[model samples]
Target chain A: MANMIDLIEKSEVTGDFPKFQIGDTLRVFFKIKEGDKERVQVFEGVLIGERGGSNKRAITVRKISFSHGVERMFPLASPRIEKIEIAQTGYVRRAKLYYLRDLRGKKARIRERQDYKKGKDLSTAQVNAAK
Target chain B: MTMGIMATKLGMTQIFIEEGVRVPVTVLKMDPNFVVSKKTMEKDGYTALQLGFGQIRAKLVNKPTKGHFQKANVEPTRFLSEFRVDEKELANYEIGAQIGLEFFEGVLSLDIAGVSKGKGFAGVMKRHNFAGFPASHGTHETFRHGGSIGMRAQPGKVLKGKRMAGHMGDELVTMKNLRVIRIMAEENLILVRGAVPGSKGKVVEIKVSTRKPKALPGVGGATLEEASKNPMKASKAGAKGAGGKKK
Candidate 1:
């Protein structure tokens, strides 16, 4: 089942993102359409959740905007995504960081992951099974 | 040439189309279909083409059927269905000539027929889509019952074809005007927009639709999917069904 979906959406996959796991702060450069014109918008937030496989893989990024919680989910391998910039990869445990939603002010801050490996690693473990 | 060919249903899956539109498509494996014989109007009183498809061992065929295949000079096919064609289009096909997925090129909509999965003898709720009595509120044995048949005195007897529960599915079913989303020529796989009759691995007859499909913007035509079931509609529906599936 996983192999069949991969073969079908293989062609749509383009531009791999950095290996930034959950709890990592990400700057997702997204392409938006305004009338007939197109522009890139950058969204900075903490990676809360990531699910699905191959071209269908999506990531949920949460950021507090104007004292209110805001979240945006984007398909990781979508053509609409121009690039993903890892602002600060956090060293955290759980697969999903939903608990961070309740915290506000200084309580929601994530510890900076000290072991920041240099150089861009092209090979990404993107063929994850849907959970 | 025949308006359509025989294929085995291979279940359903989702695939992406252009501009990232996810389309639900059913996979069908079709063998190379061939013309076994031609029924001429001068001899047979009607113009029809006998299409042979699917593989069968020579030893498995009975002596009579084996002899019939020998006359065609082609390998014995498991299924042989006759499809009527106009006298003019009949000239395009020759005995033993094969038809592939390319035959349906540029056709955006089609009809598929197959024997539906049998659900045995069912009750009124599942079989006929009857709204049975309420389950709660002290509903006794009449919960799943089929309410009432008819009133007393005047016409007391139950009306025929009243949509009552009886035999369900396992019947020859036809799904009309399914949009053709994609056609993988190399894989011989057609990705239709919606569901078709029957379960996985079941034999399905796919052809041009009799009614024009309004699902697509410009695609238009009609064809016969049940030529064998309704032989009387063969010539008329065959011509129309051909136009439906042809590019």
Candidate 2:
């Protein structure tokens, strides 16, 4: 039998998004509604963390603005999100890039994954796809 | 009052509605809820509907339980509960009629009652939210104590119903004015906005809230919490007259 909670959450997930890991840089196109007009805003940042489950999945993105760190969280299943484009793939030892908040300038750079083209991170990609 | 239904707590999850706002919702699975019997004002001195839910095998039921289902001509149910209703409202239901999720259609809020998770033999700090003695101070084992129970002399018998340590939780608790987020009739599920008392699979009583039904937190206007925080805004919102006393 299908899990009732899963069935209910599945109804809210309307889009098919490509898999991206924590260290990857993501370019998010979010819809902003102002008065009677709606416009798309682009936010490019490194994926810091991911949380929640099923249709409630969310991602934390971190970027430097005016030399100050700014982080924003977005629900992956939200309809307001136009699309999430994978800007660049990276390799990191930890699941969260929260430690990068303390580092600045050249020290905060992420190492690009050499085998990203080959999809060597297929294992984590498969797990996220299942969710 | 309207009739209440019985449902199982299916834990909690979040959903993103319009505008990308996230709402934490509790999923309640309502099985086939049948009207087992009715109590009339003339016979039982009060009007109420006895509801039965959660089907169980006949062999598992005792003789009296089996006979009760036999009297109603309904299948054996694992749980039976009563929802007191106004004398006039009692006319809406008949014995053995099944109540579905549609009953909550257009309802804004609800009152959910269930047994809260038990925390055996808890101290005042844990049970009553009492601040314990400072750990750095000379306080020893009395950290979790309830402190002074009574005065030195006058009327000093540890006054009745004083806050003290005892059994905590595992009792019938009613959470009122819980916003009704979404209702899925096809799946027999009602998604309530916020937490419901009890652990997953615990049986709960669901009914319309007795409180003056305010405009659900963020359906259209400002949320109740936000309104209360700004009296100037609340008064302005009050002029629009969203919620009124339950008549």
Using DockQ as the measure, the top candidate is 2
Query: Which portions of model 1 show Cα errors greater than 4 Å?
Result: A1-6, A9-15, A26-30, A42-46, A54-79, A82-85, A90-131, B210-247
Summed backbone clashes in each candidate are: 7, 0
Please list the C-alpha lDDT of all candidates, in the order they appear: 0.71, 0.77
Lowest summed-lDDT stretch of 10 residues in model 1 chain A? A122-131
**In lDDT terms, how accurate is model 1?**
0.71
Among the numbered candidates, top lDDT falls to 2
Model 2 regions more than 4 Å off: A116-131, B214-247
Candidate 2 per-residue lDDT over residues A1-131, each given as its tens digit: 23767765666666667778889888899998888899999999999999987787889999998888989998878878898877777788899999999999999998876644554754444434544
Q: Give candidate 2's whole-model lDDT.
A: 0.77
In the range B1-247, model 2's lDDT, one tens digit per residue, is 7668999999887766554567788988888799899999999998999999996887899999888888888998999989898988888888888888778755667899999999999999999999988887688877777788899779858889889889999999999988766666555677787899999998999988766545533434334453234332322232222122110
TM-score of each: 0.75, 0.84
TM-score of 2: 0.84
